[model samples]
Target chain A: MKTLIAIKEQYHTWVHEAFPAMHPLLLPLCNKPFIEYLIDFAILAGSREVRLLSDGQLTEVEEHCGTGSRWGIELSYANLHPADDQQQLLDKNRKFCGGGRTMILTGYNFISYNKQKSYLDLATIATDTPIASCPGGTITLKGPPESGASEKSPLAPFSITPLDSVQSYFRISMETLQTGSSRYVLPGYGSEPDCSIGKNVIISKTAQIRKPVSIGDNVQILPKTIIGPSAIIGSNVVIDNGCSVSGSIIIDNTYIGENLEIDMRIAAGNTLIDPTSGVSLTMEDPHLLVGIKTWATTAILKRKTIHALAATILLVLQFIPFILLFPLLKLQGKWKDDPYMQETGLAGALAVAISLDRFPLLLKVITGKLDIIGSSSRSTCAGKHSYPDSGPLSRLAVFSYAEAEDWPVNGSDAAIVERFHAVHSTPIKDIGMTIKALINRLTKGR
Target chain B: MAFRLDTLNGITVGIAELNGRLVAENSTILQKTCSDWQQKTPFLVFDCSNLDFIDSSGLGTIVGCLRKALEKNGDIKLAGLNAKVAMVFELTKAKKLFSIFSNAGEAAASFAASPVSSKTQ
Candidate 1:
């Protein structure tokens, strides 16, 4: 049997806005994308090939699911006009629907089916028409001709529900987490009924696990953490120490800090969210935690350009001063080299006072390898640190707010100020901050 | 800084009416002003009838006030919280911490109907 999975534009519109970076079908329902359920259902129904039809961009979906080889089914993608109806969909993809019993699963709504039953047999014996569906979509059977019964029995009949609102989204996730398994075939693994675990999962012995939990692959649940009752943890996730996750779904590649009370929320990447109300909060403060997006190519290019310009300007402006002061300072024993400090510490008071230590780094900024003004270039030894991107900071500047504003060096407050400036500071802001830093340095006799 | 206070019966219920916005700049001001107001009665009502918005920091400060009031063997109840403010409170589960009422008069009367004993050490 062949399956045509057709999703309407209305579905894509909601999913696109609901999850901008994520694919709609792949939007996780209890740590598993919504599409996986549909795919699993199609496979269970004995579909040898499945064609996904949508008006929206399917690049992300295609990238994720590929050719459906993982599920041992042929997966193909096609585009549909917003006005296209069921007949139009079939006409457009006549070749794919060739001469066989075709099951058209249309709409953005979710299908509910059990994997345990032999749906392939049911497909053969069941009436040659749409068997069941909600108002949002339907599952109809269409094909040229079929032989007699090929193992005829109704599959475990299930109800397909539409995930329309944030409330429904939350409810579905919570229910799935609570049930630990869905009426449909779900991804991941479970040694027991209540827990569905995925690959490369690491649960610290110190962590507490309550039943009805779903954890995806490469997940690290740290010490003193409690997960469950209703929790869905996705792939490549890290839950730090002393945190509690109940009635929540942590999406892929998300890092949750220690002591965070995440309840009835969805932590997707860096955004802490409430799915019930569809109200998401980009955590403004770092101790609360923030999302860190991998630097995009555009950002890298922009950073490099700014760095190079800043480096060039600094090299030119400081040329005369460096040439004149170097020999004199060296002769006066004030310019003595400190290799030890360079190796073990950031520059000393002498370099800071002279403002010489920052000069070379400023050049690196122009080359686009470093921020003109950024986080203190210090590695985080411990704890969560937040940099504000939602606010005014643009992440490209020299002489961070921490230095110019005289925030205490290397402390939490300073860290906050620097992070705020680093993320918010733009190229124009860099000029202003650089001037402030220079003025402060000169006024302080440094 | 417009506010109102009334005592319904012997319960000594005081209502502080908040209007406009409650944010970081004025959140501290609210806390300081509420401290003095808290002295008038252990059980107080904040009539948020006109309160329109509240952020996380502002919500934190209010929760802090609750902790302070609870510490002093007193209680602070909320009345007429608008949808936006209520949402913020509910999202943080801060709503669970306070006794919420439909109106200021109802909240003030509630304090008299059931006087709370001190659980605070």
Candidate 2:
């Protein structure tokens, strides 16, 4: 059986509003991303292929999941119209669905299923009804039922939870933690009961951990800190000294300040939410609360080297035009600071043609402060909430990918295009796009 | 920031209504305004029902106001802090430093309900 996981952006709009920076599919449940659980469920249910369909941007999901080689399954991604019905969804993905058995998993819901059990009985579970469904999601089998020669329960025993709010998200995460991979294959290893710890964990001897806790990779529990009794700590997190964290989730890349009482709350960077209390706080002070970023060492080195080389070349190439014309234009009162908005007169036009206006930004790229091609937002520096809950999907750069593709500077699809390039771009391709971006910036409307 | 003097149960309380945003741009104005409010009454109640957003500098300014009030043997209580504003206080542990109430009246009344501080022994 093949699986088609149709999670439209509409079904999970709450995820967008609550955690604008996080892709709903990538939201973690028990240290495993929400999408991975779906994938795992599909794999266990006798499916070797899976396709993730959404009406929103999937570049981040794609970048993280890739071809699903790690899971030993073939995985693909596609887009959908938010208004499309089940029939239309099937019609759009007809080729992939084929004339064989297909399992349709739609809506933003969590499926409570046991991994150890064989859901192979679902292959023959044929009725004109949904196998199992919840408020926002349904699991249905499509195509012809496999020929069975024995009598058995047609549908497997399982339930779905409609994940439509932060409260639900929190509830589901806690539920997953309580289950502790017995029903699902959770990340990390458990040398003891009700406790799972990940790689690079630095637990001080003075620190104490209660039972039934899940800690992700690269976590540091400092001196005299108490973790768990039902805590979920995500990757790259640090709990400072003299703190008590019980019944809380410390999401990826967060720093818990000294002596803070975090009980029954979800801490994502500086934002802390008590789902029960319906209050979410954003701390402006990094010392009190902060999000950490983990960068790939080799990938960053490659990107910086390529960006630095390309920027240096561009700087040398534009040196003469900038030196000769910039000062003259400034003295003539024709040089505009915000040239991208509107550059008037022949001098300004000529300056644009030679790419003299982008000289300073290019120098920044050479200094490794900016990328040769990235998002054009100067204020979207790293370590800020530019991209929100997720890591930085876009960056401050000399030229944006939208400029390269000649998309409208502030167009709606600019984000879509920019994110696509941001995820799939190579440093080498970035250089090519940099040249195109400059050319497009110079001549797109002209 | 707008300040009004209120006499609740015979205790003089200064109530400041912070509006729009308390950010870097106008944070210093809040400090100066608080200094003026302190002259009329050291016990102040910050009516934050109108506050929509705040930055670190704005938070620092409010903390500064509280410090000045304390120096004059007075206290600053916060009232009607919307979820967004309350979040700022909660995250920085600033909420722990002040007495918070759902409305301005209650916050002002608290000053009168309690025994007044002894006059520096």
Candidate 3:
């Protein structure tokens, strides 16, 4: 017996737009993809060969499935026209479907079935009639009529639901993650119900799994994090720690950061989103963390324009201060030379008096290597020593928010205070904060 | 910032009611305005029954006000934080910094019952 699965461009478009690098068929529902469910359904139905047909670009699907060698089944991919009907589809693939018994699974619908049940045997020997489907596609059977077979219960418990929106998508995934692989033949193993993991996953011990969750394969859950009761983390993802993920679906290849809260949202690639509302927010700030944007297109000129504008302003602002304070600080031996010192955690931080040390750093900000009001730049050494939750915004600034507020200059509390300002502070606000910092320094006479 | 100084059971407790968004736009105004209120009565309660949002700056200002009150040997408590603003405090771990009450009246009354500090001592 052979199986025919067909998906069209109209349905595939959502997959491509939602997941750029991954194939829609391979996109996991729960921790499994919609297509894998079809494959599992085909394998159960006593089919040795499954042919996938789509009107969209099937290259991604082909690369992913690849003859289905892993499942020990002959899987082949083909394309159909946009206007092809069911009869036309059958005629076009007559050779593949020539076997007297054929089970046709079509459309972008999500088929919900139990792996433990023998639904395939039931479909083969009991139902002789073709199963007509709705708008999302339906399951139909053809070939020859079955011999005197007892009437069987309708496939009510195992229903195929269509995923039309992001809300449904999030719900389905969260449900699957919580259910785990034992209930659904999931790809990975975690022995715990809180973790429904997929195939080929890499989990670090330092990373904390709170359970009642589902995780996909080829995933890296980084250190010092909490993942939850209703979390669906997709495959090929990196969840960096000091982060808390609860009631969320983190789509593939998404990079979450330390001390970040991803609650009630679906983070697909670089897009931080509210999936239920379909509100996609592209975070311009990368230091906090970011997902990878699938499209490589960018306007280089826009960046250059902003940098040039910033440079002109900085050069003008720093002229008098740079010349006057440089020699004075150097003469006092207060201007210490530390190369890439910011990354060494908060300790590698150099304490500069007032507005004196900001002269050089301002140039870095204009060059775009530094954000004028962005995260304080951390030194490489400091980054290594700092704990996952240890103030993620530890990169020291010549003028810190804590300094402006007369708080302790170089402690964890100071780092937290500064980081909060760094994340919320904008360029316009930076100008105001910088002035306040200068005034504070002048009044303190430090 | 609407502040009311009341004496309950011979204890002076100042209740400062905050309305709308306590954000950077007017967080400083709260600080400057609340300074006089802090001086009038050391024990205080910030009634956040109508507060909808609070950014980091607003949070800082509140912390600053708390510090000022503490310096005068008294304390400031929070009351009636809505879910959204409460979420911000929880995320930043600032929820631990205050003695939160269910309502402003409760917070104000708690101060009178406790008499935060002995004025004569």
For chain B alone, what TM-score does every candidate structure achieve against the true structure? 0.89, 0.93, 0.92
**Higher-TM-score candidate of 1 and 3:** 1
> Which candidate wins on lDDT?
2
Docking class of 3: incorrect
Give model 3's share of reference contacts.
Answer: 0.05
Q: Highest TM-score, which number?
A: 2
| Model with the higher lDDT, candidate 1 or 3 | 1
For each candidate, what TM-score against the reference? Answer: 0.67, 0.81, 0.53
**Cα lDDT for residue A62, candidate 1:** 93
Better of 1 and 3 by DockQ: 1
Between 1 and 2, whose TM-score is larger?
A: 2
List runs of model 3 lying over 4 Å from the truth. Answer: A122-135, A146-157, A192-207, A217-223, A292-446, B1-121
Per-residue lDDT for B46 in model 2?
A: 93
Ranking by TM-score: 2, 1, 3
Write one digit per residue (lDDT tens) for candidate 2, span A1-446.
88999998768877765666567888888798999988988998878889999877787799999998999999999989989877787888899988778898999999888887778767676674778788897988888887762455444567889988889888888888998468888889887767899999999999999978999999999999989889999999999998878888888889998877787788887788877765777776676678775668789888998999998988889898889988888898877666252456777777877678788778788788888888766323322332332346667777778777854545445655676787789988998898887777677435
Candidate 2 fraction of reference contacts recovered = 0.30
After superposition, the stretches of candidate 1 with alpha carbons farther than 4 Å from their true spots are A122-128, A151-158, A178-185, A200-202, A236-242, A253-283, A292-446, B10-12, B19-21, B36-43, B67-73, B82-97, B114-121
Q: Rank the candidate models, highest lDDT first.
A: 2, 1, 3
Report every candidate's CA lDDT: 0.71, 0.81, 0.67
Query: What tens-digit string does per-residue lDDT give for candidate 1 at A1-446?
Result: 88899987675455545444466678788777888888888888788799998876576689889999999999999999989977888899999988677888888776656666667664565475567777778888876535566553545676677777666777877776665374656678776887888888888999999988888888899999999768888777888888888888787767886666777887776566677677665544443444545446786676567656766777787777666655655565555453112311222344445466566566557656567665543422221322232222334344556667775655566556765566566667766776677677656642
Top model by DockQ, which number? 2
